[model samples]
Target: MLTYFRQRYPTRIEIDEDGNTVEVPLSDPMLEAKLHIALSTDGRHWFPLNANEPVWDQWMRDPYVRRGPDGVWRILTTGTTDGYNRDASGPGCFFASSKDLIHWNDERTLPLMEEVRDASGNFLANNIWAPEWFYDEENEEYILIWSSSFKDAGWKESRLWYSKTKDWKNFTPAKVFFEPPYSVIDGTLLKHENAYYLFHKEEEFGAKTGERRAIRLATSKKLEGPYQIVDGDLNDGQIVPVITEGPTIIEDPENSGWLLYYDYCMTNRYGASFSKDFLNWEILDDVHFPADARHGCVSKISSEEARTLINEYNISSSTDK
Candidate 1:
């Protein structure tokens, strides 16, 4: 039997030495029904961890996974009926928890905007995309940030909005987190050596450059403060002025360098870059990642936690039949 291979992007370019181009064949369409957890041990080399049940049947995009104080893995993802980012509703972000990432609990939509209002004094948001939380140990507060469009912006511009909470039940008034001259989305923050680094995608386009959705960096002395666009070289000489989003930065546990990963949505794959001083980057090619993995945050977990999840879930690198 001859197997028919389908390309995710029909117009994807592939150049040869002589300047000849070819259409690249990407993923197999046979794997679409298997929605599994994308797990990686080395920030690269990702594999699909099959779930015993079809837990998420709908739109579960931009998943942010982190370990809570109660020693449980919690996930807050953008929830919608059609699995499209533009179709996100006002019920806020979706929430779920698990002890071993095998058996999930408390799966429901969290009303993050119910008690909070926008600049127009309205508590409604047209879209809620990629809700992520950062725990400040010193202040004992959870800083929640997500991309949303407002009535004043005519739902045309997406910006990063934030709220703080000690307990998830009660939240501080939502406010603008980062708004540049243009629009931005998929904001992720990292604190290193008393400085806060914010990574976000700026939505801009020009005649020369089409769909200028590039991941950029900003720095601030405080968590909520006047962050400025990072001066000097950012991508370590990498030409990344377009077609990137969902930048997730984490310190290399094995080394002193930092691993920065972004969704190369143009090619439908994740692209990674490594930096030591946060100014220069070495683009890592051929890093393994899940094909179906979308915008998601990564966290370091204990070895026991990974072992428990693998054992309980019967998770293998390959999809189960």
Candidate 2:
């Protein structure tokens, strides 16, 4: 689909009702999701991941884009980008699927019948942060990882929850995968060899003069885990805090080295990193960065899916004026 933009002005017209002139201020949908100001019909292709046209009428944020086995690239993100106030307890993770990376269809009505909640019996709830999902080939299971809050808890106390299913139409109840006074937000998972590795960013307490957050890792012997922290570096390995977040790791099909992608908040640019081992990482500048005026952030890079879209499909490029 093509997009169009216009500079709109709210024209004031007085309407006489009974004996009074009533006026209304035309409403403008919030342009930015909590973090992402733009979106894409394709997997964040073109620039300004958001459309040139205003498609997101609700408050959508923390998008996790992935491709399912059926050749459908599914984007699961938080917020309605239109209707919900965030605390209203609506469908937090908005799911959208696309085939050519240009035209997208919201999958919210896909009959997702799975129900997973927090340990407190408070049902799957708020914040609706970065959401990542994968197809487990071995178990034929689909696992979704996202940052969510318990209905009764504080914001920084958000926990990472995982739901498993064999089909996208059905989901299992959310169970806490990670939690904290450490304030862990977005948890990204990858299946490599004999174990499952998870990378997450957490807000650290008071530190030196200019410290912000830390990116850490945890490993599990099984998908369902008693996970153990492997290593954590809040310093961005010297990249700085504002430049670090939305970490996603995937195996490079060209070699054994893994690639990591994330949005650099400080410079408002997205980049890639490489690691022979999941712990030691080095950022690379070869991958193209989306060029949105609002930081032009990329929510994630799913190598398995993005590769197919970029290489095989007839993807279209978009730019919003």
Candidate 3:
């Protein structure tokens, strides 16, 4: 029992007419849905760059964001603001920028550039999930790594694809990064020590994919490479998660360790853990605290610091409790 230690912040907040903090509600029906977004931080509390706006586009799940060279934050996600209509089977990838993590502007239709149409010239009408944008400083371009099932591609046969973009306005043709011989999804790539490594969920058998998914690692010496798994492997590492999807690694700001965030299951819930290195993960069991909202990605904030923020942000919470 001691292996699991969860602290659920079963409380709610009330904002005033001016959109400022006002009172605390004992219960928040909006909790789960409100916690809906794949919340991120500018190094603090988890939040949406622009939550609930027309520009948002799609279901907006599995977020991959990074700060660009100019200290400007750029976000690329699976879906757009309006999300995917039935006509469009895939939630298209998009670009949004924010100086801070709270406010964001869509680079899709307005301000930034036009939408990325497909080869048919009708725009891609299929599934493209977990998009990772990689910046090549030397090439002065951005490359996209995404899980796509476009044009007759089957879910069980999912593959990773790549494309190039220079000004965020134009995108070149996309081709299969590696799409064969295995059921691989959620291709998250990382550049480490001058090598580029891509991680994906490898299925042993059957179409059932989930939190129990195995994370397979592949590497290429150059950006453009014949990417190969470490030892022709299919996620045979002892530390890397199996049945775990969406592997995101953040280097611990305080030390050399890396904190990894990934999906524990469906339903708005997930888990947090830290790794001494990228290979293994130690789950922060029952370590829940007052997150900015329910189901939001728990930020780097510790339980103690979260308590402080809750006390500070929603003072009336205790009264309602």
lDDT of each: 0.64, 0.53, 0.49
Best by lDDT: 1
Best by TM-score: 1
Q: Assess the local accuracy of residue 119 in candidate 3 as a C-alpha lDDT between 0 and 100.
A: 65
Q: Estimate, for each residue in 1-321, the C-alpha lDDT of model 3 and write its tens digit.
A: 000111222432333445343334343222221212222332222322223211233335445556667767676654443323234322456557876444677655211111345566554435565667778887989888776554443244567877888777777766678764666777766677888877666643332322334556677888867787654222344234454556665556555676555453222234556666455556666433223222122224345543543343332211111
Q: Candidate 2, overall lDDT?
A: 0.53
Candidate 1 error regions (>4 Å): 1-35, 51-58, 82-91, 115-124, 151-155, 206-210, 232-241, 315-321
Better of 1 and 3 by TM-score: 1
Residue 254, candidate 1: Cα error in Å is: 3.5
Tens digit per residue, CA lDDT, model 1, 35-122: 2455566776665544423334534666677777767777777666332233232447777777876577888776666645557765
Residue 224 error, candidate 3, Å: 2.7
lDDT of 2 by residue, 34-138 (tens): 322233333323343343333444334555555677877666665454322243343356677777455677656221212444566444554456667877887
Estimated TM-score per prediction?
A: 0.78, 0.64, 0.62
Clashing pairs in 1: 236-280, 236-281
> Which segments of model 3 are wrong by more than 4 Å?
1-59, 80-91, 107-125, 150-154, 203-212, 231-239, 266-269, 272-277, 280-321
Give the worst 10-residue stretch by lDDT in candidate 2: 1-10
For candidate 3, the TM-score is: 0.62
Q: Which stretches of candidate 2 lie over 4 Å from their true place?
A: 1-59, 82-91, 109-124, 151-155, 207-212, 233-243, 253-256, 285-288, 292-321
Q: Candidate 3, after superposition: displacement of residue 270 in Å?
A: 2.6
Sorting all predicted structures by lDDT, with the top scorer first, yields 1, 2, 3
